[model samples]
Target chain A: MQRYKIKISYDGTDYSGWQVQPDRVTIQQVIENAIKKITGQVVKIHGSGRTDNGVHAVAQIAHFDIETQMLPKALLRAVNCIINPDIRIISISKVSQAFHARKSAKSKEYRYFIWNGDQVTPFLYRYRTLIRQPLDVAAMKKAARQLIGRHDFSAFTANPNREVESTVRSLGMLKVTRRGQEITISASSNGFLYKMVRSLAGFLIRVGEGAVKPETATEVLNSQIRTARVPTAPAKGLFLWHVKY
Target chain B: MQRYKIKISYDGTDYSGWQVQPDRVTIQQVIENAIKKITGQVVKIHGSGRTDNGVHAVAQIAHFDIETQMLPKALLRAVNCIINPDIRIISISKVSQAFHARKSAKSKEYRYFIWNGDQVTPFLYRYRTLIRQPLDVAAMKKAARQLIGRHDFSAFTANPNREVESTVRSLGMLKVTRRGQEITISASSNGFLYKMVRSLAGFLIRVGEGAVKPETATEVLNSQIRTARVPTAPAKGLFLWHVKY
Candidate 1:
């Protein structure tokens, strides 16, 4: 058996997230179906993480083990041919059996896009969340700084499907930058709880909107309890940018 | 009657061409319907030019005369609210009665995008034309220079819907530039013949692929007849970038 690690990019507009479900079409199910058509083997592929529906990915990593004689390049082409054009297998290579797609990931980066304009541009409506009111970037940056270290981020996560051993996470970076009418919030962490990045984005946006003070971020972190103040930004603006191994 | 000039932007993937045809959904038809809903008047809007089906626009110009009490800003907001999200009224202003969208235009610029890569990025598939083979950007640039001048460009235009008095057009600029895996072909002219920009792009692509010599552009122009060698590029890659009046 050979394990193949693949780098993928997908526009998740038409997908029901990355996980496989009973009836809904998903990114995982589509890719797995394409692999089965190419290799004639039913295999379970593991993704780095599950992205919510309508959340895009620039470089999502995954791995699958199969008994096949085809080279990684040829398999990549064959799998891509069978899958929808919205999902592309960027590159594929053989890996050791021990290298799990999820467990082996060292750090992950996610970026949230906000169109801080009176009206969202027509071509950009799908990729960005529209914020009609002008945001205070300075306030957002100050608030983002408060969340940039190790802490129990319970206030920044949604309910998980399974029990987690711990909610403490080392957020390596949380940066907010704006160019023209687009604001980008980039977050990097060793690992994140369910919906944590979107929660962070939403909190920062509230700060930018003057609804919440910048210093309030520390109080929310110390509380470590989920509250309405930390809303989850829509999935469409969030992108799983990269997974570093 | 107030004559209003509007700058519009649209993602043309879901609509027919700019012109209205029976049983076909078009950009003009949608905007007209939106105007009727807003003002209760059936008014005809004149576009600077017609874009082929699937061709996008960044700043397409148009004008209409209507009797209404609403201010330009209010009318802009109301029309946008009624139209599909894919089409936007970027700006609207009252123009003089003698101003015309098409007749008064002095020059127009169009841009064509080509993804000269192994595969088109998933998020950009609708906006770019994918060419699997690597293109010679230097060669394409050399060929493009030959098209930048006043000339009788009979060989470059497609079949017109109506008879034209002359085919002579002042080609102000024809530039080819590449950034990473994407190539942009920009054309500016006093006026373009039907499908002229796409025809130019197609011919230059053939030259970049080494299928045609760079110097052959002059011969094709001098022939004063359309030939099978110059295929029209797909409308998906074309954009009505701007119209200068």
Candidate 2:
């Protein structure tokens, strides 16, 4: 059996996200079914990580094992031909069997888009989160800076009822920028918990709104509390931007 | 009766253009329906121009008369509340009763967006037209420049069946700009014929693709023939940017 790594991009709308579920349409299931039809084998494609419903991905990396003599480029064309236009196979290449999609990732980047304006443009309704209030970008940037380096990111997760093995993670970057009325918050981390990036984005947005101070990031990180962030940003504004292995 | 000038923005997807049809859903029909519901009167809204299906607008100027004591701000909010998220009334203001939306407009601006890349971004699928092949922006820009000044633009018009009063129109600006993978072509003109802007855009794109020469723009214009420009750009990429009255 040969393992192949594939980079993908998807709209994430009209999808149940990256995981498979019974009787529901999902990105993974759609691709798996297509693979099954093409390769005549029941195979699971392991994604770098799962994205919730309405969360888009630009360069999501995944891997799957198949018993086929087809070349990587041919497999890519075959898969892309059957898949819908919303989901596209960006690239495909042969990979070592030891390389797992999820475990082999060194870092992942996420981008959250916020339209801080009186009203969101109708054309941009599906892509950006509208915040009809003024936001302090400098404050948001300051707060985002504190999120860099190693910390227990329990505060920046959506799942409160469940416990994870560990919450400590190293953040490579936490960048906040305002271009016109749009505010973008991007983060790169070694690993993230469920809804971690969204929660972090929500926290920074609150800081920008003057509801919270820049110093609150340190407090939340040190607290190791699930409810510390209070709310997570909407999935529509979040995009899985990159995954570096 | 008081005439109100309204600036509107809309995502033209799922809409059958701005004009009201017998059975098809349209922006004007929806707005008129909402006005009927609010004011209990059937009123006609005169738009600056008609947009084909799937063509968006950022600042589409329109005027409608109604017998109402409600303030302009209140009217704006009320119309926004009833309309779907895809259509938004940006602003409403009192205007002279004689002000006609189409006839009184001094100039109109339209913008066309083209994603000139190997792959189009999924999130921007609905908004931009994707062209995978490389395009020469300089060639396109040079070709676009020929569109400036007064010219008989029968060649750029789509309709061959309809006889217009005059095909001569003054062009204000035809600016072609490329920012990375996205190319934006904005044109300001006294008025445009049926699909005139789109046809002009198509001509420039062909010039950029090396299918035609930059000098062909003058040839098309001077030809005084409709078939001089063959292809018309798609509606999804066109946006009615503004109207100056």
Candidate 3:
């Protein structure tokens, strides 16, 4: 069997997320089903990581095994022709059999966009959140800087039943920028716990509104309790941007 | 009564067009109904030009007389609150009573976007056309230069019943750029006849594909026959970018 690495782009509006569930429509299920129809084999495509429902991905990496040794270009075209129009196969290339999408990744990046204008733009409503009140960028930046190191992010994760004994993870970068009425928040980390990015964004928004202080992240880090963190923001405004090996 | 000029933006996928029509929803009808609900008076907004169905606008200029005196900022907020979510009022300001949206415009700018990649993106599918082909940009640019300057553009209009006395129109510029899998065409003119910009784009695409000669536009213009021109492109990929007074 030969393994293939594929780059994908999708609009997550009508999807249940990247993972395949029994009765739900997902990106993985759609693609895998299309592959089965093309190759007549039930194949499992392993993604770099799972994105929550309603979250978009500009370039999601995945790996799958094929039984036949066909040309990569033909496989790309054949798979795309069978998949629905909402999902797209951007590129495909052969990879080593041992290349695992999740284990080989060194870091991941995510971006959250907000439209901080009085009126919501019709063109941007699907991709951005409309916030009528102007956010304080300086406060958000100050609060975000405190999260740029290895620390226990237990408070920022919503999975109360998390089994991992070590909750420490290294944060590579956190940036906030305001252009006109649009605000963008980009964060990178070695690994993220479930719902961690959404909770961090929610807390940063509260800090930008002056409801919380800049050092609130430190307090949340120090406190191992999940009740100390802010609510999780909606998944529709979040995006899985890139993955680095 | 005070005359107010408003700048508007809309995603026209759900509307019939910029003008009111029977048995269909239109951008004009939706905005007018919202205005009537806000000020308790009927308003007639004169737009710069009529856009075909599924054509979007980034900055459409319009003027209307309001009997109730209100500040520009307040009017902007009030109108936005009542307008449909698909249409947005970007800016509003008081203008001279002599000003007219259609007659007082000195120039107009329009943009057409095409995605030339192998796969189409769902998020951008409604906004742009997916043209999966290798385009010759140099040839398209060479053909576009012949359209500059004052010329009778009867050959570039799709309307057979076009009754304009003089088809002489002055073009400011036309540029074609290829970025990644996208091709963008930006054109500026003092005025455009019925279906002129769409027809020009269609003709340029044919030229880019080597189906027509580079000097085909000049030949069509010299012929002065409506049947000598190419067909108008789909309205979904066209945008009224801006209007200069």
Q: Against the true structure, whose lDDT is highest?
A: 1
> Candidate 3: which stretches are off by over 4 Å?
A82-85, A162-166, B82-85, B120-123, B164-168, B179-181, B227-229
State the lDDT of candidate 1 residue by residue for A1-245, as single tens digits: 99999999999888999999999999999999998988899989999999999999999999999998789999988888788789999999999999998999999999999999877777888889999899999999999999999998998998643335988989999999999999999999989998999999999999999999999999999998889999999998999999999
Residue-level lDDT of model 3, residues B132-179, one tens digit each, is 788888898988999888888888887645755778788798888899
* Residue-wise C-alpha lDDT for candidate 2, range A1-245, written one tens digit per residue: 99999999998878989999888899999899998999999999999999999898999999999998788887777877788878888899998999999999999999999999867778777778989889999999898888899887878877744545777788899999889999999899888888889999889888988998898889888888877455888888989999999
Clashing pairs in 3: none
Q: What is the TM-score of chain B in candidate 1?
A: 0.97
The candidate, 1 or 3, that scores higher on TM-score is 1
Q: In angstroms, what RMSD does candidate 1 have relative to the true structure?
A: 1.6
In the range B21-138, model 2's lDDT, one tens digit per residue, is 9999999999999988888988999999999999999999999999976798888877888989899998899988789999999999999999997666666767788887899999
TM-score on 0 to 1 scale for chain A of candidate 3: 0.96
Q: For model 3 chain A, where is the 10-residue window of minimal lDDT? A: A160-169
RMSD of each: 1.6, 3.1, 2.5
Q: Write the per-residue lDDT of candidate 3 for residues A131-152, one digit (tens) a residue.
A: 7777899999999999889888
Residue B190, candidate 1: C-alpha displacement in angstroms: 1.8
Candidate lDDT (C-alpha), each: 0.92, 0.88, 0.85
Error of 3 at A29 (Å): 2.5
